[model samples]
Target: MELSKSGLWGDQGDGTYINPILPGDYSDPDVIGVGSDYYCISSTFHLSPGMIVMHSKDLVNWSSIGHVVDDITQISPKLNYDKMNHHGRGIWAGAIRFHNGKFWVYFCTPDEGFFMSTATNPEGPWEPLQHIWDVAGWDDCCPFWDDDGQGYLATTHFADNYQMHLIKMSNDGKQLLMESDVIFHQYKGSEASKLYKINELYYFFHSEIRVESGNEVRVVMMLRASSLYGPYEEKEILHTHGEELDREPNQGGLVQAPTGEWLFITHHGSCGYLEGRTLSLLPVTWMDGWPIIGEDIDGDGIGEMVWGGKKPIAGYPIVLPNQSDDFKHPKLKHHWEWSHQPRSDKWSLTERPGFLRLHACIPLEIGNFFTVCNVLTQRAMKTAKSEVIVKIDLTGMEDGQEAGICHMGTQYCTLGVCQQGSIKRLKYNDTGTCSDGPIIEGSFLWLKSSWNLDGIHTYAYSLNGEDFQDFGGQYQLNWGFYRGDRVGLYCYNEKTEKGYLDVEWFQYHYLSN
Candidate 1:
């Protein structure tokens, strides 16, 4: 049975797919094709279970297979639930490659230097992240292997005037040899480093900004040289083509399909905070040893975004990312990740069998819902209208505990039940503003949150799961911390750890506009 659909986005089931093939906050995507299978990874930032790994047979349809990092705290203690810090600093953009019969992932934190991990299977058992470089101020990094087995890493250093570098590394992808050469330098804002070799020419694909009409516009730029170290020529390959320059499609990977068609898998550069950066698949055309992404709509010899196109590979079952948890499995679904590293003892699926038990504890910063570490979250669908309802058993709730459904981005809105002494009351909170409803006189309550494409949100509560009464005033979703909006379940107390909530199940669906 179909659990959920990607709404009006994704594959159209007619050999045509629309823009934002994965219509969520799947930003800074890097994809690779191995045999008939393709694997893609995206930046997760501070969200735990770090980098998300997606698998696809047809590049237009994807499934969240696994994550590269299981314990984000392994990178730093600040990422732990006790700290609840690093709002947007954890894992930046990384590169995933099938190298030497293993899948290799390399990424870095703004303050924690560089790290790499390896796994034989894409759905792996990935090895613990291995710290490769201890230098800070670097962002995006991608590895390359030459025909002679020489390994090189292409990265961008923010502290050094936005200079992109090419450094030598061990063939095993573990140690950076420290031999570096500056390839591209000193643009307005240059990043997203991807290295590729095509037809005997070394190609470097990165995104940078250009001042247009006094506004900075992000566009994809390419560099090519006969050797690793330049005399490389640079060209602007992809941009908005005189349209809304801010939402340009940039920062992705180039992979060739089984039919020998080169495709660019990227995210729309800047969108509303409500949607974040969404994934888009574009056709890549090669001209004079350079790759042109999207279409040159205005015939300006540059590429522009295409709203719809023929599927790169046809006849694959349309699959959306996992949503709607039944809590029947022993492990959390791949779609779910904590806002930060969660305290393992604070949550469980096996404890209650068919439910997820969240043991409420005082947040490090009491009363701040964003600081609550046990909030289980996933990307909010980038649709005009979407709703999620969660059935929560409030019998375990104690005084000072608030357990409910919430959507978070720049600002947060929550609707749930709060206990004060002996009274269980329905509460709606938009950021720090709280409004309390009538006392909930039932042992079980269902909380619902819905948002529109404009980012306006509403909250409601139901006693019997049949009818819901709207409670909270309209709230607006805002994007912040380099993230799009996220919706999930949160349970926390301002007082003690004795309070908890048993989540029976969560169901999410996209409504027609």
Candidate 2:
């Protein structure tokens, strides 16, 4: 649903917008301005169709355009459904840049080394990822291109005492020279590197943990150097100005608007596991050739997070990332992604004409929904209250097949239909524990879940679309797998892959407080 029309967030229509430009998980945001259009990419750890790419015109309104990687198996087989591992891993943090007439994306998995992909257009048929470095224990990588057509990579080695490195690369960004120079090493937990050459000075943006009054806080930092291999100067550019640094805003990229105004698009770096790290756009003020993020509320020469602000570019109709699926299109929406790489042959849109047909597969671990191969999901909105309702046809169900709507975080809860031989029963599965309900004779079921920003989940079901009966226990939403809680659907079998479920439509609404 559109953010403006829904009143969920963004574009207040009074020339100012709220903090979260988009209301959802959307963590570790990296944005770049390609002419009049702005593109943002977020960390999609372990989510198939990894590293979501979004587009915006006014910086306040954004929509999902596509993803960088389609098949995440290129990173590792352990991330597949059979393995069902790497929950909080995969696609750590990445940077996006418009260079050489192509959109280049660079990122590193925590276990696997660095990888990259490129496309001429952001809504893309992106080139397959190129594994540049095969070494491990490195992450949060960004690429830089010099005026002389030279390429360099700035990354952090977390295993090596939080040491940051600068490595030379071919102009093509495919090969990284093993010659590495330690750039910054003084800070603890320093990472999220983005390299930029602004006005003849090299500005390296990153984040590091610091102890203030016995509180560990993550803050945005900057390193300025005259040369690539630098005698560099460091400064803390942005941090929470409150007495307690709870939601520290850090780890994002800087972009210049069409009006020459600069802004930082970042995530609320802490105390946000429930909804995941959400997107925040802050104003950038350049002082002494360094960009200070947000507003200097206390006038301590450091920027604090701004809750509301003037739009970067005015008068753009508000847009939000895609949220619902009608199952009418032949291809899945850009917002939908599998928990891991899906068994593509088992799910089809054309097979049922106007329904999403999920052919049940035998889960690698029976009775465990987490190991289900084809759990299709999209990011759950972090609103005051949000609701998702899905209608599914159980005519295709066979013995031992279960299909329903779900709310997945670190822990998950499902409300659906479970078939036992010839009898169909309503079931509620909460994190592997099951609570069976009454038998259902109807072929169609409407499953719904309502959640609040507190992460409290309430689920219900209906034989008729208008009436719903609450079935599941009140479960708290969790921020697990380094991701925000998700709203999705699932179908799987405990015995064989003979059953299936047809989803007619999935509707999501952001309820007003």
Candidate 3:
């Protein structure tokens, strides 16, 4: 069913309304409304072709525009050893806006500090990376272009010390005008601060932590000031975990609908064996010069999710691109990203008629999964049944050519073919530990993995597409340190040098009810 028809789209009749727009792994979202259209971008850590930009007409539906970082060579290459510099350090938090007729995006890599890039158009040839601030500990930088043509950058320091600062940018956004200065020292372990100016007051919406023994409270807090550089006054808590109307307090963004209404878009933790993140939306109204969130009519701390608003000027049902892959084309889908930098020549399908070929390169240390450069991955959008079918021609399998399918994140598993001597073997590995499954003598084999909703599933290998055998025991999908998991293909070096895997075709089928 289309997302709108699924009761997901929020329409505000008088041309603009609000909703928890893009319900995906798009965390730390920052959006800007240019003219009547809205454009948003989010963080992509350790994933190549980082900084994904999304577009929408109303606040309900969104579509992918392009990536800010398109070239892997422009960023760090995929490292061989897992413990290199920053393993998956691409773009983290991004702030997009139009300043003085030029489109600008300010973003940061946790270990790389903050930077800005500009483009004439949203889907453009963005300019080369321009260094704005390079302080190691800072991240989640959001920039605001004021009515006076001045720019202000706000960001949070990493948890290493828990600090937050706001700096002034030169009029042209070429450099920082002054050293970083304190804005608010709530020391509440604040991050993801977005500064919004309404009327004569400027408000800072941020997250704060309350410390207690097993009573930790991470809530969304707000502060307002008359001046940008402020002795600001604190306001009531906006929302928190377990609120009936609000999802658990997580990174979020606030945008004013075209009809002058306000809405909040944020993510909530999906608690279960698979801790995937889901997005949520709530309505906001101004009361006594302060923005009232979730409509606290009873003066309770919690807020409730509500529906029906003036339909946004342009409203479309919330829809996501198909996650399943057919592999009928010569190139990978835009949703797939490499773990680290990838050499273009290392993989290709254009020359091979019906196969996707990946050439194994230098073996990086395999202890850590995030640093594996050749792992191609896509986010697990929603918990659903899915499987991948690949036909592999193992005729040229050398000691160094190990190709397989994987579910990647902090933790991962692999299921595919491995050739040893004259014997072709089906291999399954759970968290770097491997075991032999089934064996076929021929050069071609079909591999399949079936994932039930709970993520524990079975793997099957087939010589003929019609018949299959359970190749391994059931395994559970686990997340190591990160919150989300991705599934895709990987080619690892099994020998000393380079080797290759020839995959005739790959298809992903999502079973429907």
- The superposed Cα distance between candidate 1 and the true structure at residue 466, in angstroms, equals 0.7
Model 2, clash count? Answer: 0
Superposing all C-alpha atoms, what RMSD in Å does each candidate have to the true structure? 2.9, 2.6, 4.4
A best-first ranking of the candidates according to their lDDT comes to 1, 2, 3
Per-prediction TM-score, please?
A: 0.96, 0.96, 0.85
Provide the clashing-pair count of each candidate structure.
Answer: 1, 0, 16
lDDT per residue for candidate 2 within 162-234, as digits (tens), equals: 8898888876889998765556545799898899999999998988888766767777899899987778888
1-513, model 3: which lDDT tens digit per residue?
222223233343345443434334666777778887778777776666677777877656666777777664444443222333454465676778777787888887765567788898888678887767666777777788777877788888765556777878887787887665655544656777888888978888877676423555566667888988778887654545443333454566787887887777665532234434445455777777776666575776444344334544554653454555545675565666676556677787775666777776655564544444567766654334667777777765676456777776566777877666556677888777878866667877788877755667567878887697776677776543333666777776645546677777667665332
C-alpha lDDT of residue 420 in model 2? 96
Which window of 10 residues has the lowest lDDT sum in candidate 2? 1-10
The residue-by-residue lDDT of candidate 1 on 405-463, one tens digit each, is 98888788888888999899988888899888999888998888887766788888888
Q: Tell me the whole-model lDDT of each prediction, alpha carbons only.
A: 0.85, 0.85, 0.65
Residue 401 of model 3: what lDDT?
A: 55
Off by over 4 Å in 2: 1-8, 180-186, 241-246, 271-273
